[model samples]
Target chain A: MATNRQIVLDNRPDGEATTSNFKLVTSETPALADGQVLVRHHYLSLDPYMRGRMNESKSYAASQALGEVMIGGTVGEVVESRSPKFKPGDQVVGMGGWQEYSVVDADAPGMLRKVDTTHVPLSYYLGAVGMPGVTAWYGLVKIINPKPGSTVVVSAASGAVGSTYAALAKARGCRVVGIAGGPEKCRYAVEELHFDACIDYRVHGDVKSMSKALKEACPDGIDGYFENVGGYILDAVLLRTNAFARIAVCGMIAGYDGAPLPLQNPTLILINRLTIEGFIVSEHVEVWPEALKELGTLVAQGKLKPRESVAQGLQAAPEAFLGLLKGKNFGKQLVKLI
Target chain B: MATNRQIVLDNRPDGEATTSNFKLVTSETPALADGQVLVRHHYLSLDPYMRGRMNESKSYAASQALGEVMIGGTVGEVVESRSPKFKPGDQVVGMGGWQEYSVVDADAPGMLRKVDTTHVPLSYYLGAVGMPGVTAWYGLVKIINPKPGSTVVVSAASGAVGSTYAALAKARGCRVVGIAGGPEKCRYAVEELHFDACIDYRVHGDVKSMSKALKEACPDGIDGYFENVGGYILDAVLLRTNAFARIAVCGMIAGYDGAPLPLQNPTLILINRLTIEGFIVSEHVEVWPEALKELGTLVAQGKLKPRESVAQGLQAAPEAFLGLLKGKNFGKQLVKLI
Candidate 1:
């Protein structure tokens, strides 16, 4: 039996997540069942939503249990297979979690899918051409649905989801404005992602100042918004939204630490006749095929280029994830487990 | 010359509006132009939305300018006509404001509409078969779109909009809940309006208590909410909402006085995947013909009954409006201008 390395959730965070909350363990891989396949993960996708799972609070997905493998998206290769469906050397994508190897039932519905990495890179499957990409597609197409020539603003502008959202909105003839934490990420969002403008939220001292900057960035008031990092930015956006504006609330990274993020002036929601909705992308399975096809094509054509902040080993995932929550990572935070 | 008793906006209120903010002025009714008519107002609609117009801040509609008749919905008789579209003794509904008479353009689109008072009472055109009735129809049918057998809650349950909304949702086979200011209104909501349950919001000391009451009232959790009072009640409802709940933001009467009504735990909006939308019914003109027809039919069949708290004369408009804002009126607040 081969040895497998796994990182488990050791404890729930008191406030901000730290490395102490995770535990690395070595164990022997169990013998394959009748319909099992062994997958050796090459890349593990680390996202802000993982922070939500670390806590015991009610979330879209189940919480990461103590002494269990931390849940994550992974692109890996099937090294051994007992089932005829998945053969050795076949690259696959699934919820392989934070581990060196995964024993998955090949017959399990929606547990794994084989990916063609001929044109698109295997790592892109964990980020741009995968869940994040599909998330952007669903929120933009289904929720926001910005009209041509309308303004759409996105938070966490240089991240996997935000970058893809900006690109998708821009392609639809929307004037895309991005809100980023620093100057570098803002530059990348505007220059590389082709966003019309980007605001460095860190430079603005308060919500009012940030609102002013956002107002300047979006000459026409925001008609749609893709919210990732909520709190002050959301309040500012509420103030700047035009009548009949729509907002797709994807994530509220600011409130993941269990801090109260009260919204001031909810009356604006009535005055502006705004429609705000929160959604989990996985819940909308019907759109996956359509969204993935467009995202895959965009990545293959280099039209949706996504950057990654790589961590060399599985041991670095905890730190990388913590850094991601703090906005330290430049783009998609990934653990190069191979 | 016919003397018109007009209630003008004297000064913008700094806090809560008072009768002093309005001035009863006597002016000669303007002569009918080639395409205009002189209307003798019989009843003026006093609504919660009127409170929003009393402030200088930006609202869905423009602020009522100082020294101008406070804008409102009114049903009256066309005493004089210059255009063939309208004639003497014809019953009509228009933006007749807080006055005994109005000079309106008969040919102006959306300025006036002739209504049948034979089947539905003339006052029904001001409450049940009119704007408030259409408001309930639009918010329920268009925005909330509650599924049959789902739970729906409406604030200001005994008021014009809420009473109509509760009745409408109940007629659609929904389990209807209502939040009213007092036990009297709560009784009216349940016994008269046919709500499944009603919460006396005044009896609940705080949001936590109110939320507990709401949870008890809505054992299945709230699927749809018609938000009329948007302060603590909105916060409470947010706590009690089920997944994918829809809220129609018709009015935020609590914040109309310029007090900050911050929403605590807006994160629930994300966690529950709620779709909250604020709408002004007038903006959706396309639905009027369909809505009015249905509303008129309901009123004619005695299926939708609305009560009125009628103030004696046009001079009583200011105090009635002020009382309406304070929850002093039992039902649809109206001024009998005749």
Candidate 2:
């Protein structure tokens, strides 16, 4: 029997998630079924959406039950295969939760991705080359459909999804401005990701002043807005949206721990003739092939680069998730189990 | 000089507008310039949007300046032409305001449209054949784009714009539901306008119950929402929108009378992947010719009928407008002036 270290949900927290909410324990893996493959986890992807799954609220997905292994995406090598589709030593990606080992059906919807890691790091498959990459692609191309020379603004600029959005919009000849929590991420966004400018929301006095700052930065007014943190930040951006602007509501990190009611700036949508849309990447899985192919090519050609903050071992998963929630992680927060 | 009886804005009201906000006075029309024409008002259209202009607050259009003639749309006859585009005895529709006679530049954007009253009543220009008709066309075809089997909900269903929207959506093969303040209008919307169902919001105890009633009416969930009375009705509709639903926001009568927020359904846009958009008919003039042609053909074929609530004389404009604001008018409110 192989020993598998798993991180379980200990308790649902009040406001922000803490280490006490998670517990780690080592257990023996159960016997795999006829079509199940035993995957040895190499990388775990920590995402903001996991915070939504922590609370017992009705959302896109059900909340994680207490004492159950916390769910997440991961990259792993097939150590043993009961199905002919996957062979021993073949590396793949799947929603394997936070564990050193997982037994999964080879043909599940979110089963796995075969990666040729010679060109890029295998972990990049969990970040820029994977979910976050597809998020930006589908949101910008399908939902927002930004025209050339359009002003696009992204919240949480240096994060995995924001970086992907900025690079993709820039490649399409759009003027992109990013908003981040601090100055360092702002600098990294402008200098590294090549965003036109980055606004430091932490230092900004208030939404009114920030609205003015955004108006000044986006002289043409915002044509496309990709919202990640959706509270007052959304309010500030809504005030500056141009006529017929399209807003893609990707995530609302600001309201993750709070009630989702009484949004401050809905009137701006009526006044400016704007279109506000909410979207989830998982809903468009059938059409995501084109987006993934494009992102994969961009990564192979070195045109798009994604940064990651890697936390090694299953014991570090809780801290990694907390860092992601606090916006401390520079880019994609990942836990390495190797 | 021609003597003109005009209704002027006497004062801005607190909650609901009343006759006290308007004063009737007789004035002489100014001498026409070289490029101007004199118009003799026949049918003055009293719309719900004018209520927004009565208050000294922000809207798409500037508020009525105190002690100034109330603004409105009217069907008039060109009594004298100083420009080649107009001739005497030509019946036309233009923005003649709330007055019996006025001077206008023949080349102005709101120039009169030639009338053909042989098949349909000329006042249809103010309701089904005019602004409301165009509003329905653009908001449905361009904004909402309801599918053949999609479910649609329209508030203020017996009013001009809402009635037109219900008829158009039903003709396009949609499951249409109308929401009105009274049982009489709701019955009219269902029996006369051919809406699939109708909901009387006034009888409902609260918005949550109203939302439940609306949801029961729309088993497939609302795919398109035409918002006329905003506030709580909008909030209820927002809570019930289906994925990828489209909302056409035309009016906010519920919030027009000093309500806190006009439309407060922000969460619906995100949770259901819905799109909410605001529009005005004036912005879509380029496509108005084709739209009007279709509406005219419908009326000429006797497939469409518009209801009119006629208030006699210029002195009745104030009471008629107040009745519209109070939701007392049965259908399209119009004041006879000729």
Candidate 3:
């Protein structure tokens, strides 16, 4: 019998999360039933949303129960298959959790997906051409719904979701502006990601300074905004928004640690007539085909050149994820489990 | 020529608005030019929105210009008309500001409207059938857009906008809840306005207690929220929102004094996947016909019964307005100019 290494939730965090909250255990792979497939994970995705799941409090997503394998997205090759949909050696992507191997019910809808790694690498499924890509599509296409020449801004500009969003917004003929933590990431966003401009939040720490930077970056004022990191960035964006701006609230990593993140000026929301909507990508599966198709096309056309920050092994996942929560990662944060 | 006594904005407010900020001025009403009509106002409407116009800061509406008449809604009689649409003895509504008489260009579309005071009282036009009623309709129908059984909550329960909103929600088969300043206002909302439940913010005092009261009042949780007053009321509502709730931000009287009002726990916005939209009713003129039609029907059917607090004369407008802002006025505050 093949043995599987898995990371399980050891305890819930009181304030800040640490690697001690997770426990790595080894167990024999369970025999697959009819219509099931065994997948040996090659890569595991680490996302900010995972931090929310690790909490015991009620949120949009279900909490990660103690003793259960940590929930995550994984891309791997099918080792064995009892279903007609998947054959042995098929490259697939699924929610395989934080594990070296996963047994999935292939017959269940959306349980597993076969992906072509002809031109795009399999790891992209966990990033640019997969969930994060779809996430960018939903917020930009469905929520923001900007017109051509409309000025749009995104926070955490060098991250996977922001990178995809920048590519998509640029394709729409929008004036894309980005806000990142450091000068290096900001420079990469403008030069590599082709963002029209990028503002370094670290250089301008307070709301007043950041607002001045935003105003200078977006002279026409932001018509649409994708909020990934809230607090000062959001407050700064609100100060520079034109009439009837739309904001898609994707993530607030600052508040992920359970600190009370107060919005400085909700009054600006009324004054500017803004529509701020919060959404989850998994909740909108109907946009998957269309979103993935465009994201795939962009990747194929080289319009979207995604960078990755890969941790060497499964044991490094907790640290990598913790670093990601602190904006230490340069791009998509993932752990190589192969 | 006619001598018109008016209240003009003497100066902008430094903090809380006071009578000293407004000056009682006398102006001559010039003779009606072609397509112009002379309106002798009977009642001048004092609304929370006017408080916003008092500030020099840019908001949804334009600032009330200094050394000019205090801009307000007025219901009056057309004294003379050169335009075919209006004539002598006709009751009408227009933005006549804080004055006894106004020379309006009647030919301008939506500048002046003739109303039938047969079944509906002329003063009701200043409250339920006019801008405030339409404001309520736009927030509830367009922004909130709740289903039949949806539980909707509105603040400023006994005010003109909140009263109308309750009736509209009830007619649509919704469970309508409200939050007002005092126990008297709360009782009036539940008994007179027929709200399912009404919480008194003064009694509850803070977010935690108000949230507990909201849990009991809105047992199913709020599906939609209409925010008229910001601060602790909004914070309390956020804690009791059901998944996918919609919020229509109408006003934030608490912030009109240029104080920085913050939204506590914006993380709840992401957790609840809520849609918080801010709108100005005057911006959506297309919805007016439909909204006004529904509002008029409800008023006629006795489903909507509006209350008003009228001061003796035009000179009392400044004091009456200050009272309205301080929540001392119980209903739609107006100045009887006749």
Candidate 4:
């Protein structure tokens, strides 16, 4: 039996999650069952949504139990297989969690999927060609339903989901505006992601100032918005949205700390005749095949280039995840577990 | 020439609208043109939406110009006509404003429509079988799309739109809950409208208490909401909404006075994966035929009995409208111009 290294949820956070909340443990891998495969993870995808799962409240997904492996997306290779379906050396993607190895049942529904890394990189499977990309497609293409020549705005625009959303909206002939935290990320959003303009939210101390900047960035007013960071950013966006605007609420990283962040003027939603929807990407698995195909093609053709903030080891995932919640990471925050 | 009694917008409102902002005037009726028809107004609809038109800012329709007849929905009879399309004694519905008479173009598109007063009463053209009815149908049927056995909630439950909405949701086999201002209105909603339960929002005091009451009223959790009164009521509803719940935002009368009423927990919108949409009924004119057919049949069969708070004359229009905004009126507030 081989040794497996895993990080488990030690405790729930009071306000902000710290390194003490997670504990590392090493254990012997159990013998393979009749239809089991052993997967050695190479990359662990850390996301802001994981913070929502740490608490005991009912989120979109199940809460992460104490003393259990922290849930995550992973791209890994099948090292051993008892089932004929999955053979050794086959690269796969699944909920492999924050661990070096996972014993998966090959016959289980939605357990794992084999990926072809020839066109797109293996790491991209955890990002632009994977869940985040699909999430952007679902929000932009399905929810927002952007019309050509319309103005579309996104928050946290340099992140994995935001970057893909901007690219997808830009492809549909929309004037894309990004709201990012710092100058570097804003510049990347505008220059690299091909957004028409990017507003650095850090420079604007308050929502009023940020709204002023957003008004300048989108002269025609925002017709659609992909919301990631809630709080003041959402308030500013609400003020600038045009009549009959649509907003897709993907994440509210600001409220994950458990403090209540109220909207100053919810009446704007009625005043502007807006449609705002909050959705979980996993719940919409029907669009995965179509979304992944387009995303994979975009990445392969260099039309959707995703930047990564790679943490060195599995031990760095907690810190990387914490940084992601604070908008410290420029793009997709990943842990190179290999 | 006959004299016309009209109410003009004397001045824009500073905060709350007053009778001083309106001026009653008598003028000689204009001579009929080649495509013209003279309409003798019978009933002038008084609604909360008129409050938005009182301000200089843009509303769903253009602002009512300060020294013109206050724009409103009216049911009337054509007394004279130059065109072959209309004749005397033909009861019609149009934007006839706050006046005893209006000279309208008979050939103009959407200017007038002859209503069947035999099946539905003339006053109902301004309430149950008209714009308010369509507004209710659009929000409840089109937007919320409630499922059978689901719990649907509505605010301003005793008012025109809200009453129709509660009835419609109930007819679809939904468990309907209503939030009304007083004990009388709440009892009326349950007994007259056949709502499963009704909450007297006045007694609840605050949003937290209201939310507690809501949780008790909707034991299975709220699946859909027809939002008429925003502010604390909206906050309370958000707290009790089930996952994937839908809300149709029709009106926010609480904010019409210009006081900022922030939502205390808007993040619940995201947490519960809710879809909230704001819509203007007229903007969706395509659904009018279907909506009106159903509404008219319901009225004729007495399944949708609409109550009225009729003010005496055109001089009573401003006071009636002001009262409507304050929830003083029992049901559809209307001014009998005859």
lDDT of each: 0.90, 0.84, 0.92, 0.91
Going through the candidates in order, what fraction of the true interface contacts does each contain? 0.87, 0.49, 0.83, 0.80
The candidate with the higher lDDT, 3 or 4, is 3
Clashing pairs in 4: none
Taking the tens digit of each residue's C-alpha lDDT, what string does model 4 give over A1-338? 57888999999999888989999999988999999999999999998889999988766567999999999999999999999999999999999999999999999988899999898889888899888999999999999999999999999899999899988998899999998988999899988999899999889868899899999999999999999988999999999999999999999888888888888988888889999999999999899999999998888889999799999888898888888888889788899988
The best-first sequence of candidates by DockQ reads: 3, 1, 4, 2
Candidate 1: tens digits of C-alpha lDDT, residues B132-245: 999999999998898999999998889998888877897799999988888888888888888899899889858999999988888999999999988889999999899999
Using lDDT as the measure, which candidate wins? 3
TM-score of chain A of each: 0.98, 0.97, 0.99, 0.98
Candidate 2 stretches with Cα past 4 Å from truth are A9-36, A62-68, A82-84, A108-110, A301-303, B8-37, B52-58, B62-70, B82-89, B102-110, B257-265, B300-303
Considering only N, C-alpha and C atoms within 3 Å, which residue pairs clash in candidate 3? Answer: none
> Quality of candidate 1's docking, in CAPRI categories?
high
TM-score of 2: 0.90
Please tell me what DockQ candidate 4 reaches: 0.76
Per-candidate iRMSD: 0.9, 2.5, 0.8, 1.5
TM-score of each: 0.98, 0.90, 0.99, 0.99
Model 2 residue A92 lDDT score = 93
Expressed as tens digits, the lDDT of each residue in B260-337 for candidate 2 is: 473443545666778778877788789898888887877887766868899999999898888887788887899998
